[model samples]
Every structure is written in structure tokens, then in C-alpha cells.
Target: MNLFKYWKKDVPASLVVFFVALPLCLGIALASGAPLFSGVIAGIIGGVVVGLISKSNIGVSGPAAGLTAIVLTAITDLGGYEIFLVSVVMAGILQIIMGLLKAGVIGYYFPSSVIKGMLCAIGIIILLKQIPLVLGLSGEMESDRITFINFHEKISIGVIIVSVVSLLVLLLWDEVLAKRSNLFKLVPGPLIAVAIGIIIYLTMGQSGDLALNQSQLVNVPIPEDFNSFISNFTFPNFSALNNPAVYLTALTIAVVASLETLLSVEATDKLDPMKRQTPTSFELIAQGIGNTLSGLIGGLPLTQVIVRSSANVMSGGLSKLSTVLHGLLLLLSVIIIPKLLNLIPLAVLASVLLIIGYKLANPKRFVEMYKLGKEQFIPFIVTVVAIVIFDLLVGIIAGLIVGVIVLLLKSYTNSHSMLIKEFEGKKNLYHMNLAEEVTFVNRGSIVKELDALPQGAFLELDFRKTKILDYDILEYLDEFKVKAKNNNIQIKIISERGIVDDPHSFREFFGHKVFKMGH
Candidate 1:
């Protein structure tokens, strides 16, 4: 494919993603309790470095909200931001090792139910986190700390009015204008909302009551000179490398960041219109390099983020160049016109995030999961609730545990089928057909079926269609064979290999060589 053939499309798409990414970078950093510039630095590296290295045509990378809790805690536990950067570097090295080991297959083990739950949970989190900002509340206060009484007291009328208008403009652009005109398609709703916010900031400035204070607006730090801008970049404290806690923190970050990146890759590929597949292992390596560079330069750990990736896809991005362009835009904006960017209201950015969150946590998704059955819906709901109550890692683990139980229950309940046949001038014949997958969970069901067999009967145990027969099931069958002989029941085992007349060879008949050898 000619990568530049879609430049016309990709350029506009990049612009849209840039607008979507800007506030997120700042918000995540604020949430992470790190320097705001670190987030932007990660965004730049994720875009230019990972984007160029990654094979994913549509996937976008940046500072992940999923890592915010981890970073916040690590910074405190590690003693300082510089020390935490050391952990990030070590994490990058670990990610590179994992990639080289081809451990990306772990992504496939995550159930779809859990992944959907994760998405929904993140959506709920984004909504809850942005509510205060949307209502004009500022600072690094936690969402739980903002009570209705305090929220009402702190609400700024000007910010509220601007936010409402910005949200409405976003809806109009997406729901109406984009559908009506091609010009509107080139310009994204987020960009329009931001522009309207800036206009309102200027329009309301003349009236003291309507004007928004500095706290209500975007806080892009304005550097005094070239030296000041250069000074903002921080280097990791290498002395922390000897600390055992640093290694532990690094391992945690590596595992969590890798999982998040792989998850986002899966989500983005599903959203791709062309259905292009991403090389998961290669993507990990790219992310590893990006994180390593980011950590060295005092940036947040980066990952393939679904929110930004989905935005890129929805906005018509067709290649990695769009992602790269967005990074360049972020770099230039911070350096050249940060003051102008600061004019945009935080409320407007919060409105943009609210829309994205609503899309992710749409009620229809829950309805769809419910229609899929309890096997899917239960895990999905559990994941959402768990994430809302706890952190991302805890919520995912809870959902995964629930999903595994459902799988085991299904395996237990549907292990085998039994049939009885009668022939002329012959004793009754019983046939048992094992399910395609017979695990330890199905051992009890199989045993019950075996115990119900009648005496002086001819039995045919069929394993022709069975793919996996557990060791416990084989052992139970071995014991049953001895009892069958005492009951004067003739047993014949049919399998893919052949019929086995000897009971000791039953495990071999089903391809369990290790079990046969032990016997």
C-alpha cells in the first residue's frame, strides 16, 4: 500500500487526534502526580519513536491513564520523581526482554468479556475524573474528595457556561454538521470545541463576573527562554538502580505496561476498517524503546492507548504517519505557542473527554453483552464494578478470575454424551462419546456417567472427536476398567490412534504418552 496515498485523509485525521491527545497528556500527568511536561514528552516519543517502529497502521501510543495509579504510588514509594524515572528505565529493559522472548501470546489469553469490561471501566473512570474539571474544579484533588456541597460552592458560572456551549458545539459538529458538509469532516468536533472555548475566554474577559480565572484554563507552562525550555527536561537518577524496591517497581510497570499495550493493539485492530493485523511482539519492542528514551528524558511510561488509537481510526487515519504528525504537532505546540494553548479552558477539554467516555461506556454495549448470555455478561459487569471500586490491575484480575470459573463450569457441564443401542441376538451395548475438550473440571461428570453403567454390558468408549483428555480423567478411566472386568462388562476403547484392548494402554490410545510411561 502506498502510505502517502491517504495523506489527504491522514493529515486531517492527525489534526483531530492531536486535539484529542493534548488535554489527555496533561490530565494523565496531573493524575500521575508528575511534572506536566513529562506527559507531553512521553506523547512526543510515543508518537515519533513508537509510531515509526510499530507495524500497526492505525494504533496510536501515549501516556496511558491505566498507568496513572501505578506511577502515582511509585513516585511516593521510590522517594522522588527522579528515582521513579529509574524504575521506568528498568521497566523498558524488561519489556525489551519480554518482546525478544515472544511473550506477546499472553494477550490472547485475556477473555473478550474481561477486555470489554476493562474498556467500560476505563470509560466510567474518565467520566468520574473529568466531572470536577467540567464543573470548574481545579488542582490534583481526588474525585472522591469532591462532594456535592463543595462542588456547588466551587462551581464557576463562566466555566460552566463555556463548557456547556463547548459540549453542545461538539455534539452539533459530530451529529449534524459533519454529516452535512465535507468541510466539517476535515475539522474535528474537538478542535471546534477548543476554538469556541478560546473565543468564549476572550469574550468573557471584559466582564469580571463572567471571566474565567487562571485555574479554570489549560495550564501549559510558558518557558521564559530557550534555556528555560531545555531546563524543563529532567534526567533519571541512576543511583536508584541499586535499590531493590526500584527493581520491584520496574517489574510491575513492565508487566502492566506490556499488558496494556497488547490489549490496546487488539482493540485497535478490531476497529481498523481494513482489518490489518499488528505484530504484537514487534509492537512491544517499539514500546520498549519509546519507554526507555522517555524515562531517560523524564517522561511518563508510554503504551498503545485505545482512546487515542480509536480516535485516530474514527478520524480517518490510514497509516503510521498520522501518528507521527500528531507527535510533531504536540512538540511544536509546546515549544512555539504554549501561551495560546493555555487560553483554552479546562472545562472544554473535560467536555471532549466526557464524549469519548460516553462512547466507550454506552448502554448499548451492556445490552449487547447481556444478549450474549451470562457467561459473557457476568465477567463484563464484574470488571466494570471492580475497576470503579479499586484500581485497574485489581479490577482486571477479578474479572479474569470470574471468566476462568465460567469456562471451567461450562467444561464441567458439557463433558460427554451417552447412548444405548440394542442389536439382534446380542447383549445391550452402551456408547460414551467424550466432548472435544475434557479437563479436570469434567472428571466428576465423566465419573458419574461411568458409575451409572449396567453390569454384563458391552461398552464402547469413543474418543475420536476428543482433542484434550485430562490426566485425572484417564486415571479414573483406568480404575473403572478394573471394576468393569469384575462386573463382567466388556470394554473397548476407540480413539484416533486405534482400538486398545489392554486397559494399561488407554492413556497411550488418547495420546497421553507421559501418563502411559508412568504406568
Candidate 2:
């Protein structure tokens, strides 16, 4: 499908994507506690490698912000960055297996509320993690629990000045400038913000009062030659392959990355002017291969990220060439200008991430979910709270549990439709129409309704709508017939075959067929 027929469009699009990807690549890496260079490696591999294999012409892959929390937690729990790489490799292997087994359909089963909660939780974590960096305080001050910020910790006036200016430019560019001019649209807000940050760094970062801490800036191995550049790559510790934690983290990364990729793919395809469909099963395989290769070279886990892909489309990307080209640009930047890239202040990246977090957990989302009603809103809120309070996997599980319970409650309450009326001289008559598909889940409602019928009252069971009858319901009806006889209550069976002359023969009627909706 990718014949590179649109290089004119793809070229400019790739450059736009390169600009959008660079800071996010660095920010996510800092949040994940991995060596800063690894993010660049992942970004390069995501674009160059995944772009080649994915069925999506417009979907761009890269280091994801969503994975920052998981990556951070896993890196700490797994002992070191080298050991965490093993999980990334294992996750790629699992994703490959998932693709081979056609497990793409599994993503559809996850409730949207749960997915939203997970993203929102990650956003909150990102926002919290960046506060220290943005404030000019050491990241270690809030490295573990961001809530424990040191009130007395020294702050950098220079960092604050740069962050505020960067944030204002980003806001103005997004809300006022971009809509007004195509030039502004082509030039992304983040790129402008980061550039401003670099300008501040070069102009004032070396001064005595405005002096910046070395720890508060981007740090990449400034390779002097080809060999030195190659030497900068970090490899996974193979010995950690035997750890159970490695397997669990691997599964988590695989599931989350696959889900994110699928969601991004869906969004990109919808935004496609051509309305082209992406082959999801094959896309997962592409992600798997990208991740495996990335981990081998000490890169962060990769996903088909929505941010970069959106940038690609907005920049008029028409082919996978744009995606591949963007990756080459990232590769070339690190190799050709490592020293220049290192001058970027961590605070500037912090401002970019801060906006990302706000977008994810915007208060409007809560109101939106509430308007959806309790059935949806409960699971959505539960998932968000759980993820924020605990971890990603546990939160999703919690949401699913709540979702299932709500489903069952609905089934129990709505098994049958009914109306109560009196005929000539009849004191009480119950007419109930069962649902189209009656299963064991409706048994309790059926039994309770049957027992609650007034003595000597006329009760009618209408099976005309019911097509699939569970044996449990059928058995309950059979036993209820015996009780109806003793209680002197009249029982009527209304099947598609028409009204039964005798209730005793109702069970026997099933011997021929459950219902005779038609001849």
C-alpha cells in the first residue's frame, strides 16, 4: 500500500513530526528513569522500523507518554534499567504471539471507560512527576512520591522564567496563532516552546545568578566519533530473563502497548481523508518487531502514538515515507548535533508534559462521564480512582468488575416486560413477556416474580419473544406449574404456537421445540 507516491506531501509532514517527537521523546525518557539517549533510540526505531512494516500509511510510532508511569514503576521494581529492558523484549515477543494468534479482537473487549481511566491516571502521574522539574527543584525531591515536595527546597528563578515563557508561547500558539495562520500550524507549539527554552539556556544558562544545575538539563552521550556513538548504546541483562517480575511487567507492557497502538490506529484511520482502513492484526506485529529491536539497543518501549501520528496527518502526510523520514531526521539530529540537543532544559520539557497531563484528565471528562449515567459513569470513575490510587492493571481489573456487576444488575431487573390489568370480574391478572433471549441469569427474577403472584390470581407467561430458552428457566416454569395447581391460581402459557389448553402439557410442548415463532 505504501508506494511512496506522495513524497512531496510526506516530506514536509515528516519534518513536522520530527519537531513534535523530539521533546516528547526526551520527556518520556526522563519520567521513565531510563538513560536520556534511549528515548532517541526508540523514536528513531519507531519511525524507521515500524513505519516499514505497519499497514497504516499515516500512523506514526514512538516512545509514548502513557507508558511513563509503568516504565518508571517497572524500572524501580525490576532492580535496574538493564533488567527492565528484558521485560520490554519479552513484551515484544508476547505481542508477536498475540498478532500470530489473531488476538487483535481482544482490545475491543476493554471498556472505553476503563481505557479513559488508565490514560487519565497516567496523565496525572506525568503532571505530578513534572512539578519538581518545572519548579527548578531536583527531580529526586519528588522522585518517589511527588506529594512530598520539599517546601524549603531552593528554586531556580531562571528555570521558572523559562518555563513560564515557554508555556505562554505554547498556549498562544495553540489557542490564538495556529488557527490564524498556516505558518503557525506548520510550526508546532512544542517545537516553538522548546526552541525558546534553548534560547534561554544559551543566553543565560551560564551566568552566575541564572546558572542552571547540570542535573536539571537534558544529558545525552555526546559522541565524538562513529565508534563513540555506537558505544553509547545500552543492552538488556539477559540474566533477568528468569525473574517472575520480568514476565508480569512484560505482560503489562504488551497489553497496554497493544491497546494504545490499536486505539491510535483507529483514531488515525478515522482522521484519514481517504478513510483507509488499517489492518490491526498486522499492525500489532509491526509494533512487536519494533519493540523487540528497540529493547535490544536499550530504547524505551514503543507504541503507535496518537500525538506524532496526528502531527503527521495535520502536516499532510500521505504515505509511510513521512513516518520513516521523520525517524531518519531524529537519528540524524542525535548523531550530527548531540551537543546542541543537550542544552535543552528539563523544565521546558516539563511544561510540554504539563499540558499533556491536563488534556488527559481534564475536569470536563468527569462531567461528560457523569452525563452518561451510572452504568457507564461508575466504571469510569472507579477505573480512574483505582489507577490513581494503585497501578494500571489493578485499576482496569477493578473497572471491568464493576462493569460486569452493572451488566448483571440490568439483566436481573429487565429479564421480562410486564403489565398488570384486570379483565371482567378478574381481581388480579399478571401478563409478562419474556425477553428475546432468556438465559440462566434471569432465573432469579423469574422465580421471584412467580412466587409473588397473588393467590388465585390469573398469571400469563408469554414466550412469543423468547427464542433461546435456558433449561434452568424451563425447569423453574415446570416446578412453578405444580405450585400453581395447589394454590388454585390459574396458569396460562402463551407460546408462539398459541395459548396452551393445559398447563400440564407446557413442558411436553418443549419436547417438540422451545417455541414455534412461525410454522
RMSD of each: 3.5, 4.3
Which pairs clash in model 1? none
Candidate 1 TM-score over all chains jointly: 0.89
Winning model by lDDT: 1
- Per-residue lDDT of candidate 1, residues 176-206 (tens digit): 9989998987877887788889999899884
Q: Which sections of candidate 1 miss by over 4 Å? A: 1-3, 138-152, 206-208, 420-429, 454-458, 485-519
In candidate 2, what are the lDDT values of residues 95-204, reduced to their tens digit? Answer: 99999988777656777776666656656766786787788886632121234256477888888888899889978987899788878766667677878899988888
Q: TM-scores for all candidates?
A: 0.89, 0.82
Q: Name the regions of candidate 2 deviating beyond 4 angstroms.
A: 1-36, 57-91, 140-152, 234-278, 295-301, 305-326, 505-507, 511-519
**Top-TM-score structure, candidate number:** 1
